[model samples]
Each structure stands twice: as structure tokens, then as C-alpha cells.
Target: FDLWADAPEEATGHQPQHLPAPKLALPGHEESYNPPDEYLPDEKERKTFERTEPSERKQHWLPEKFAALRHVPAYEHFVRERFERCLDLYLAPRARKNRINIDPDSLVPQLPDPKDLEPYPTRTAVVYRGHTSRIRSFALDPTGQWMASGSDDKTARLWEVATGRCLAVWQLDDVVEHVAWNPSRDLSLLSAAAGHKVFLINPKQLWDTERQLNTQNLLSTGFAQAAAIASDEIMACRWDKPSGEQSSQGILAVLVHQRDVKQIAWHRKGDYFATIQPEEADAPVLIHQLAKQQTQRPFRRTKGVIQRVSFHPTKPLFFVATQRYVRIYNLQKQALVKALQSNVKWISSLDVHPQGDNLLVGSYDKRVCWFDLDLSTRPYRTLRYHRQAVRGVAYHQRYPLFASCGDDGSVHVFHGMVYNDLLQNPLIVPLQILRGHKIEESLGVLACQFHPSQPWLVSAGADATLRLWC
Candidate 1:
């Protein structure tokens, strides 16, 4: 038996049980129970829907009793205003005050029209620094491979033009006054002037033998005698110096001048060259022939001191710059062709154009004058751009351009056109002003020349540097 005994149950099969319904509180309450009409009033009772006065509409929503608080105390308002004023004083937008008052047009000079000036040559491609003293003169080879420089340190150095590598260096007994490359295509040689001696050098022979020493394995046993002979030939004329040493030798010819040579100019054919000496100003210009290694007097005595001389590129004519005149002489006829009266007192340098129809003269008065040989003795255009006395002048052989360097430590390049027609005035446009070489103790650019066929320039400065600009 289970804990509890089951009572007898009545069985009502599948019948559902039902409960009584909920009763309403009151009869009227049930009728009024519509949720008090959702507690909504008429449209006039709603503040947002009611009409408002214009002044009331602008006022902030607050109790009317708080109007006195809205009108702040005068002293408190002044203190708050002062605080905001201080903040604004520090935070306001500032007006920029210019330190320099400049006129736009005066920043740079108004360049000439019709002829476009080239961009300035400010990019220095190479800085050659082998010269111990001021570089007095330098010349670019016709092939544009090497440049030869002469310095006051009594040395003449050959440099690979594109790389600025020193290939060979030769020492001299005195200051090297000038360095020039043989213009002849057949002869690969260089000429350097020191005191009264001019040395002609064959670069290939010197450089080729120099490169052979490293490859010969000279320390080996059997080839000792051959190496010894080669070594003697290398040192035959004292051609080379130890590394970092300055010495000179191995020259083709050394021509001695009677007096100190002030300037040297090569003939167009490269077979002959001329030298000017102060002591021989009254004498004819001395012409030296490379083939015979002989010096000859070609021109008769002129009136004034010879300042500079240049040979025409294509003609047999040569120009002589004197104190007050520039004279042109024909080598074949040995006669004066024209006398260009340079009204200036001192003509410092002169250069002949490649076309052989124009000449440029630079003077001590900071003036560069261009003369048309076919037009007149007077200058067609006189430009006064340099600040100091002109030191050197050069004309590009391939371009219609000319350059002038002065003691002011500036180089000015110009485009000068000699028109074929007489009615057209020659257009003279200033292209560039190159300034890099510093003026130290009154030294500046002493010499400058353009590459024969390329748009490049090489300048020798008194700062003992050679800068190449392209």
C-alpha cells in the first residue's frame, strides 16, 4: 500500500470547466471610460498652436517674473564685457605687416623684346681644383675631351674635360702665363707658356706609356730588362712626377722668347702662333711656326701699345687691339686692312667672331663694344654692363653669342646678330649673368672660353678654380 489511499472519484469524461465574468465598477463609469478623451484639449489651449505677439515671439521662453534678472547689473555687465574684449584682443584675425615695400616692376630689369634671353648659367657642372695658385689661362681642346690650364704656381695641367680628372701635370721654372691646345685636327699637342719658354707636348705618348706600367707585371723574372728600358723611356725627359708631386718634363719643343710674353694667340691653321711682349710693343708681332720651330716678325711697328691679338677663324686676317684703336691686318698681303677707332682710352681685350665679319672689344671703362667689320669702324652696339674693368672677352664659334668677364667677378653673355641686310639693325640681347668665382684680394675671372661645338663654357678664375658650365 501506498502512503495514501485513493478516494473514490466521479468520472466526467472530456467536460470543460467555466469561470464567472468580471463585473463593471458602475454603470455611468463604464460609459465615461473612453480614456478621458485621451487627455487632449482644444486647439486654443495648446501653447505651440496659439498666436503670439511679435515682441513676445522674439523673447526667450521664461517666466515674466524673471525680467529683472534678464537686465544684468551695469557694473557686472561692464566687467564681463571687459573679459570678452581681452579674449578678442588676443584671438582676432591678424593683418600681416610687410617689412619691405617693393614695386613689382623694379624687382628685375625689363628685358628686351623680340629676342629671348637664355636662362642664367647658375648650374656648375664641375669644379676643377688642381691649380695651387690663380689659374691665369686655360683652353679647351677642339675635340672637347681635355682642357689645359696654366697657373701662377708654375704648372700646366691637362684635365679630362668631361670627368674633371687630371691626366698629366707639368711643372715650370716660372709662372705659367698661358695654355693652348693645338687647333690642328691632325696634331694632338698642347702648348704652354711660362716666362719666355713655350712647351709643346704630345699627350698620347705620355699617357699611353703611363698606363702600360701597371699591366706589364714588372716584378716578374725574365722581362726585367725590357721593363728597365721602358722605365727609362718613361723617365727619359723627366716626364712624370711621383703621386701628389708637381714636376714637369718630356716636351716636344720649348721655344724661348726674348721678353716676357703677355699674350699668345694661335693661327686658324694651327701651324703658327703669335706672342705679344711688352718690351716688343714697338716691334712687329712675333709669329712662331710649329713645323720649323722658328719665330718671325710679321707686322710692322704700330703706334700704340698692343693690348690683345686674335686670329680670324676662316680668313688670313688677324686683329690687334691697341690703346685707342683696333687694327686688322692681312697675313698674306702684310698690309693693314682697316683701323677701328675705339674712342675708348684703353682697350683691354678683343675677340673675332666665327663668321669673320664682326669683332668685339672690351675696355677698362667697363664697356664692351661690338664692331661690324663690313659696316663701319664705329661700334654698332656699346654695352656697359660690367661694374669693373673688363679682363677677357670671347666669342662662341658655333653660336651667335659672346661672353665678357670683368674684375667685378661677373660673366655676361650676349647674343649679337650681324644681319646680312644693312637696313636691319643688329640685335643685341643680354642672355645671362654668371657669378660664382669669388673676388678675393682684387682677383676675379681672368679667362673664359666656349667649347667649339657645344653649348658649354669653361672659366679660369683668380680663385684658383676652373668651373665648367653647360
Candidate 2:
């Protein structure tokens, strides 16, 4: 009989599959029904062993000294352990990653180089140094040749931009809180806000004889109608003519408020202006018409503490910034248009774009936020380059430049290109950081503004100096 040939056809190269026995089933000293106490671990050692990973453990099972086999508990993880063993025997290990055939550099957006975007304020050109105390605010006239500044020294000084000469100075009874030049070139008028009043002063010497006469006549004609106007028609402020020494100093008329005026913003036409008395919660914002000599409270009750107010360049929109929000109101409709949430702790300054489609906000949280009005109410970009609180922010009227000044004693200039095509997002590139003023008494730059016609920037600092960056 050919036994080998008949049994499985005598497969010479093949051997029986050897399946290894499980470690758990294999008998060892740990599996002993009644192991010695010395062979077993104490409670602390067992806890340490339990905490150790299963793969890192010295043994697969713990040693237990039981009095009887009936006291032994069943192995809870026996089925799981056997299943894992079966998987290891059947399945093969694998490693894979999806590959992409694209260049890494192409993923980034293309932006214009800062060097290509010129005509921005790159260096300090002039420094006006007359204020005995910190300068609070300043403005450039429509011609861009003259500048007006309010200081804590209870004075407002006019300066010639090129020579840094103090052309004139008007002393007030209290610290000058704010100052702004009328946007009208036909009239050479300046507004100064001090304690409880706003002075409409015509610096007659700054302009020619004809222009000065026209400005004087325009301001004088308002007083003739002031007496005829009813008192109740005026909201929270009164238009009163300055007398005695005030008239000689070019003070044309004074708008007296119940509370101290903190800010003054003029409309593009120069006939209308607005003032904010933040202390008065009920009547904080007042709009005044120069020709009518009337003061009107636009809002019956302001929601929050007023920080700053601004006017749209070409629209009838008025921007009122509170602690953490900027509310826009339409003067014609007398209704709320949009409320911008700045996402900041406390807003220190607010400036609308010349195109009126964007907004710039500075906050005490050391952030400068840019908002595209067409986009979300949240900031389109939140920049935090300042080491201290941001005190001022401004946008150039005729340029694609924006600047922010902070308590860190630095002014960061950026090239903010707003594209006409709505599909293309605005490109912002940091240009320069101009630093010169020394920090004084926990404060640095307090206010900043751009020139009306030129790419010049003027910043008023708590160091009692105004720097012109061109």
C-alpha cells in the first residue's frame, strides 16, 4: 500500500499551520488557585500595575492569593484580548496619505508691496511746540496750509503747517477739549470746544480781506436771527454771542451746552456741525445749523456713554460711537441705519472713510479695527501691533492710507487699498511705524488727523507737541 501517496497526496512542501496558544490560558505561577502571599503584589503595587499600560505591563495578568478557587473572579477582558489576538493574526498593517500635486506658494493671496504704495506719511516733517500741556485734538483746514490745535493749557493755537509757526492763539477759561476747522474754504472759521461751550471763531487774519469780510458777515448775520428764534426750539444748547475780550480775540459766537463739550464734528458743507457732551446721558449729541443758529438734539436718549461722533463725507449719515459700538443714523430719515459692533472693550476714537463705505475704530484694548460697511458688523481686520491702548485712528481723505496712534508712543501707518470692485477684498499692508514722542504720565499720542488735500499726517500727543508726518 502506498500510504504516503494516498494520505493527502503526500504534500512534501506543505506543513500543518501551527496556531500558538494564548498566554492567558497557559498555566503559570500567577494562575495558581492558592498562590503564596509573597508571590502576590500588595494593593499599592497592584494599583501601580493597573495604572500602567497593558502593553507596558511586566505580566499579562495580576497574581492573586485566594483561599479557594470559588473566590476567584472571571477574567473580564478575556474575550476582548482573544479578539485582538485574532485580528493581529488575520489583518495586515498599513500606512497611507493622499498626495496633492500643487505648489505651496500659490495658496497665498497676492498683495501690493508697501514700497509701491507711496505718498504716505513716512517721516516727521514739522513739530509745533507751543502748548504748555498735553494737546487733546487738532485739525487741518480745507486748504491744508493751516492747522488748529486744542491743548490742556486752556488755549487753542493756529499753526502754519510748513513753517510750524503759531500764527495765532486764543486763551480760554478752561482746558480746550477739542478743535476743528470748518471744511469750507470760503470761510476761515475754527471751532473750539472747552468747558460747557463751543466757540465759533473766525481767524480773519489767516485769509484775504474779501474772504475775511465774507466770513465776518456770515457769522454776524446769525446773531441778528438768534433773538428772533424761539428758546424752546433750541434743544439742549444755546447760541450766545461772545462779548468783551472774547470778541476781540476773534470769537464770533459761542454755543453753550448744559454739560462740557468733549468733541465737535463738522459736516462736509460746513453749514452744519455736531457736538458731544458725553457727561449728559440724556442729551449727549447736539446738531447745530450755522445759518439758522439752531441747536437740535437728534436723539431723545443715547444708549451708552458717547465717546466720539463723526459725519459721513458725502451722505447724510451720522456716526455716533459709544463704549463698544458705533451707531449710524440718517439725518434726513431721522432713523437708525446700522449699528456696528466694534468687538472692542472701549472705543477711544472713530473715523469714517472718505468714500463712506469703510470705518476705522481705535480702542483701549490696544486694537485698531477696520470695518467694511458692506461686510459684517464685526471688523474686517483687527490689528494689534500696539503695546498700549490705541488712542487715535484716521484715514487720509485723498489717499489709500490709514494710521493709528497708541499709548505705546507709536503711529502705525498702513496702505489700505479699497478696491472699487466689490468682489476683490481690500488689501491692507503695513508701511511704517513712526515713533518720536516720549510717553508721559501713562499716556502717549492722544489724537491724530490727516491733511485735507495732502498726504500729510498730524498727531497730537500727551507730550505737549504736534508732529507732522509727510
Tell me how many clashing residue pairs each candidate has: 0, 0
Candidate 1 wrong stretches, greater than 4 Å: 1-120, 205-248, 281-284
In candidate 2, what are the lDDT values of residues 154-200, reduced to their tens digit? 99999999999998999997899999988887888899999998999
Tens-digit lDDT track of model 1 for 51-149? 676345532221211134445333334565567567766576445455998899898755476235453344579999988799999998777878899
Give the per-residue Cα lDDT of candidate 2 at 236: 78
Report per-prediction Cα RMSD to one decimal: 30.1, 9.8
Against the reference, the lDDT scores of all candidates come to 0.72, 0.88
Best by TM-score: 2
| TM-scores vs. true structure, each candidate | 0.66, 0.82
